[model samples]
Target: MSPLPLHAVAIGDGLTDPATQVLTKPQQAFAFGLVDEKQLAQAQALAQEAHDLALAQRYADAADKRSAMEDLVPLGARNLPEA
Candidate 1:
């Protein structure tokens, strides 16, 4: 099948500690793939790089970065999963 248009796509991936709360998990992944203009492979590579860098830090630091990124997204765009 042909690839979907970038505007038609919504992709997300993240790592979480086993004890992380369920509702918060999606929010963490949201920072990676949402609102990207890059091709999927490039986006995935960047996300992998971010994930690897995050993994090198303490969990709390990574979580803080995710939260900060999410905050930068406008409210309308932040509601993707709800739609």
Candidate 2:
């Protein structure tokens, strides 16, 4: 018995170049799978770094706003108008 022509099989530690072939749909799929895996990993790492930076900036901004509000509180003339 032999493997079917269109059957999907896993390559085990093979030295196949994923982006060098375009013969069948399965080959294209395999290439895209490799590219997508790499792209997704990179995107995930970038997202995590962006999220950390955003969180740090937000915290710093909140602290600055709090300090500004505290300084204004001592003036007593910046109170809200009566409603």
Candidate 3:
């Protein structure tokens, strides 16, 4: 079958491409035929990649929020107000 990108094809065994590594996990898997998806189109696979990326961002955001509330950051010197 012809490749989706039309230019990212890798021939022969034991060969690798830097371009492939740059692709998202789903994209790489789909491109390399790691998963059976005869009914799945490349566009749909790309959409799945988008979905996964969005989900990853959510996890990262949660981690960021937790870090913000944690004592991981060092507090600088300050003065106390008179009581």
- The top-ranked prediction according to lDDT is 1
| Candidate 2, position 5, lDDT | 89
Q: Estimate TM-scores for all models.
A: 0.33, 0.28, 0.22
- Candidate 2: deviation at residue 54, Å? 0.2
lDDT tens digits by residue: candidate 2, 1-82: 9977886787654425311111122223224453255444443343344344445665454434333432322244323221
- Can you give the lDDT of residue 40 in candidate 1? 33
lDDT of 3 by residue, 1-83 (tens): 88576657655432143223222333333444543354224424443444444456654544343333222222331111111
Off by over 4 Å in 1: 1-53, 79-83
Rank order (by lDDT, best first): 1, 2, 3
The RMSD (Cα, Å) of candidate 2 is 25.6
